[model samples]
Each structure stands twice: as C-alpha cells, then as structure tokens.
Target: MSTWTEIGDRCWVRRYDEWDLNVGLVAGSDGAVVIDTRATAEQGSELLTHIRELTDVPVRWVVNTHAHFDHVVGNSVFTDATIYLHENAAAEEDLAGTTFSVAKVIDLGDRRVELLHLGNAHTSGDTVVVVPDADVFFVGDLVEESAPPSYGEDSFPLEWPDTIDRVIGMLSDTAKVVPGHGAVVDAEFVRDQAGDIGTVANTISGLHHAGTSLADALQHTEDWPWPLEQLQDAIKRGYGALGAPRRPTLPLLGPGSSA
Candidate 1:
C-alpha cells in the first residue's frame, strides 16, 4: 500500500516509496484538489480509494505538476474531474500521445480546466496548483527534499532559481509547498534547494563558456559543492556520445549532492 501522511485536516501526502514519487490531496469545503495522478492506472486507483475514505466531496480539480510519466500517466482515473496543467504540458501530452488528451478534459464533467503556462523551470511545462482557500501550493519537480535538482534535456537549470523565486513571492507566509517527489516542505526549504541548483547551473555555465572541454570540466568537478560520482558517470556518457575525450582523477561524491 502507498504510505499516506496527513498534514492538515484538508491536506494529506502520499508516498509510494523512498525514491518512487509523491502526490498530494487538498480537501475543500465544497470539493477537493488531487495534485498528481501517480505513475500508473493501478496506483491512481489506490489513491482514489484513500481519498474516498476521507470525504465524498467530488474531486473537482486535477492538477498535473508536469508531464513526466510518473506525475501524469494516471490522470485517466480522474475521468470525472477537470484536468489542469501548464500549456506546455498540454502540448507535451499532445506530442507524446500519453493517455491524457485535450478532448478527455472536456468529457470529464465538461470542465475546461485552466492551463496556466508559467515559463520554463524544472520542465518547460511546469505548473503549480494554488489552493487559495487552503493556502497551499502543489509544485511538481520544482522542489526536491534533500536531492539536488535533476537537470534534464528539457530542464532550464539556469532559470530554475528565478522560477522558484516567483513561486515564493506568490505565496503567503503560511503557504505550504508540496513537491513532486519528497515530503512536504516549507518555502524556506524550497528556496534553499533553488539556491543550490542555481549554484550548480552557474558553475556549469562558467566552465562551458570558458572553453573548458567536457573532459577538463569533469576534472574540475571538485568546484561543485556536491558529490560528483553520479554526475561523473553522466558526464562520461555525455562525452562518449559526443565522441569527446575522457578525463581521469574525478572524485566521486555520495548521492544527494550536486554531482
């Protein structure tokens, strides 16, 4: 069974595993908001069962934090709620032919869910669901617990900090931040992670602009505050793919470091 943690009368967090993923449920006087649908149909159904036990209030809104399969594939289960996402997310869904489709949103209670496209951050399609009454923001992938931000080909690592700053500015002092993969955290934790990610991105940018070959940059991995073992592997793979020279003498760091 998925582990569920209750944060408030109206807020509960669900963890599938230590590194699996997480989803949030925000109860409302009239209805509720289901943060992310889970990675598979079965998982989504399990989550729905838990929500039903809490309140019979219809799930009026379903928010897709990002288009990652782990975060959005199960949206099919919420066939009755309006699905909302960032415009870029919708576009991604369209391109990939994921189970979710624009037509499905209309069929789901005829609710044309609002898709607000906040510019690039974790992914080009990142969107935060604001529970106005509950004063909670459900952010996906944008904030991690202790893990360094994962930079993907689609991610804007350099712009991530600014996006997080905007999110903090939009929240009240008491606003809660529910991230995509970890335990619920406060705005302060979010800021700290953003700062770390910014640092790594800046370091990479500087090295890249300095004509530091990928091999030379890997040699300078010590410059990063985090460990570089995992990143070293990634770097090696990247260089191999590009047919670039490999570097030696790279020190490895433990998991959760910017490495």
Candidate 2:
C-alpha cells in the first residue's frame, strides 16, 4: 500500500512499498506536475489514481529524476503530459520527452517548477525538481535514505560526493527535500548523507591510489561505512572512473537558484 504525505504547500510525496519509491506531486489551480511515474505501466496507472485524491486538475508535466527503470518506466501512462528528462538519461531510454542538458523551467499554471541537471551522481542524468514557491525539492536517488547511495555500473562514484555537495549548497536550511525512495527529509539529512557518500568515494580513491586490485579491494577496507554488498558496485565504478579523465563539476547553485 502507498500513502501520501504533504511535505509543503500543495507539494506532496507518495510513498510506495515496492522499492520504497517516493513519487512527488505539486498541484496548482490550473494543473499539476508528477515527479516520477513509478516502475511499470500498471503501477503508473495506480499512481494516477492516487494523484486524483489531491486535485482534479490535469497532470501537465511528468519529470523523471533519472533514467532508472523504477523512476521512469511508467512514463507512458502520462500520455498527454510533457515529460522532461535529462539529455544523458534520454539516451539510456528511448522515451519520448523534452530533454534538457542543464536546466529547464516548467510553468505549471500557478507554479513554477525548475528542473535542474545538477551533475552525474547516481546516474549520468539526474534531474532535481525544485518547486520554488513551496520550497520543496524532489531529489531522486541523488540522496537516498532507505539505503546507502546506489553506485551502479553507470553511476559516477568518483564524482558522486561532489555532485551531492552541489545539492547541499543549493538547498535552504529548512527546505523540505523529498528523496526518490525515502520519507521527506530536511537539508541537515541531505548534508549528512553527502558526508557518507563522500566517505565512500574517498575510500575508493585511497584504495585505488594504494594499488589495491579490484578483487582485493574489499579485503583492505575493514571499516566499511555501507554494507559490503552495496560497496561492491561503488568500488568497481569508482576504480573505473579513476582510470579515466574526470568530468568537470557543475557550478554550485546558490540556495534557491533554479538555474
């Protein structure tokens, strides 16, 4: 079962049991914006039903935080709404939607939603939805609460901490942040998570610099911040990243800076 929690004025987060996913909604007098479509068409349809309980206005926009299967597979359900995906994420999935390389502003009749591509963290393309009026931010897997940050084959583990630092710099001290798969959180929570991710990234860097082989990497780190299972991908990806040219980091956005 899923439950809806109002995190800000007219901004709500719907939490689902599967994947512990958190879908966001920001309703306006003229229309609404759904943050993510869930994991499947049937799940997306159910999400649409849950949305109706908040407002009857048409869903004018759908923003996929990233191209992860769970966050975007259900996009087809929002047939009429204009879906927004980061250009990199668009390449991963052949979903028809408006693609933005850096940022885009969505006019939701009475509300303004800023879709920002902060930097590569969990995936090459991750969108941070900022509802300026409500001070509510829909940050996908960039900041996870249910578990440690996910570092998949596509994740930029080496740059994950820096990406998260940019997110922290852009948030207000009191902003209500709705993570992709967790309950609503505050800036402090985001800060702490950034630190943890930084530790993971730093550890990976140190191990790589110390000539630690990928297979023998885990053996060297006796004090693991995250579960060993979760760190496997992080180690692999981090090492891979360290071997390549680093991507430039995006400029830090001031608190409430939409662009």
Candidate 3:
C-alpha cells in the first residue's frame, strides 16, 4: 500500500515507493483535488481508496502535470472528476492518441475542467495546479527533491530553469511544494535545483560552442559536480545522430562519487 502524510488540514502527500512517484490531495469544504494519478490503474485505485478513507468530500478535480505515461496513464480511473491539464498537454494527448476522456466528466455528473497552459518548461505539456486557499502548489516533474533531474526526449533543458523561476513566483512564501517524485520541499530547494541545472546546461552549451567534439565533451562532463551519466549518453546520442565523432571512454566513479 502507498503511504499518505498530511501536510495541512486538507492537504496530503502520497509516496507510493522509493521510485514509484508521489501524488497530492487537496481537500476543501466542498470537494477535493487529486494531483497526478499513478502509473497503473491498480495504483490509482489504491490512492482513491485512501482518499475515501480520509473524507467523503467528492473528488472534483484531477490535474495532470504532463503527458508522460507515469504521470497520466491512470487518468482513466478518475472518470467522474473533471480532468484538468495544460493546453499543450491536451494537444499532445490528442496527437499521441493517449486514452484520456474529458467527455467522461459530463456522464459522471456534469463536472467540468479547465486547462491552464503556463508555458514551456520541463516538458511542453507541463502544468501547475495551485490550491489558492491552501497556498500549495502541485508541481509535477518541474521541481524534484535532491535527486538528479531526469531529462527525457520531451524535456527542454535550456528552458527548465526559467520555468522553475516562474513556478516559484506563482507560489506564496509559505506555500508547500509537492513534487512528482521524492519528498516535499520548499521554494529555496527549487531555486537551488534551478541553479544547479542551469550551470550544467550552460557548461554543456559552452562546450558545444567551443568546438569541443562530442567525445571530448563527454570526457569533460566526468568532472561535473552533478550526476550526469544519463545526460552525457543523451548528448552523445544527439551528436552521433548528427554524424559527430564517437564518444571517448570516461572513467567510472568509485561507487558514490558523481563521475
């Protein structure tokens, strides 16, 4: 079973597993809001069971952070709630033929949802859900807790820092942040992550501009303060696709060091 911890009177953070992902719940006098759904239908249903135990408040809103499978595939379980997302998320869902139903809301009881498109950040479809009265922000994958940020095919590394800044600006000073993965953190942690990622991106950009071959760039990244093996592989693949030189061998770090 997943673990649920209350952050406030009406807010809770659900940690499914070490790497399973986390979801948030915001309960109001009238109803409740569910942040990202789990990856599978079973996990999503598990979350609902926990919510049912806490309050009989009808679930009125279901907000998806992005279009990634882990973040949105379980949306089918929330057939009764209004499913909200960023406009780009809806568009991507349509293009990818992902099974999501906004129409199901009507059959469930005329529940309606709005898609608020903030802008491009983590992914083109990144969305932020704010509990105005509670002063809480449910940031999907945009702000992670100490773990290294994972950049996937859809991520825009160059624009992620600005996106983090925008999210921090949207929250109040006391607002609690619930990330998609890891523990709940404050605005300060968000700022630090932005700075760290920005530095890594800038370093990579500079290397590219300085005519450093992809192989050399990968080797140089071995000394990066942040964990970047995955990112290095991504860079190498990107360069290889463009017919760039092969990557050079990088020494493996001793078990714990960021190599």
Candidate 1, superposed: residue stretches over 4 Å from native: 1-9, 95-116, 229-259
Cα lDDT tens digits, model 3, 35-141, are: 88888888788778888987888987777878877877777788788777666677876623222332122112222222244556667888776655566777888
RMSD of 3: 10.2
lDDT of each: 0.68, 0.86, 0.69
- The candidate maximizing lDDT is 2
TM-score ranking, high to low: 2, 3, 1
lDDT of 3 at 192: 76
Model 3: weakest 10-residue lDDT segment is 102-111
- lDDT score for candidate 2 against the true structure: 0.86
Candidates 2 and 3 compared: the better one by TM-score is 2
TM-score of each: 0.75, 0.91, 0.77
Once fitted onto the true fold, the runs of candidate 3 whose alpha carbons sit more than 4 angstroms away are: 93-116, 233-259
Tell me the TM-score of model 3: 0.77
Clash count per candidate: 0, 0, 0
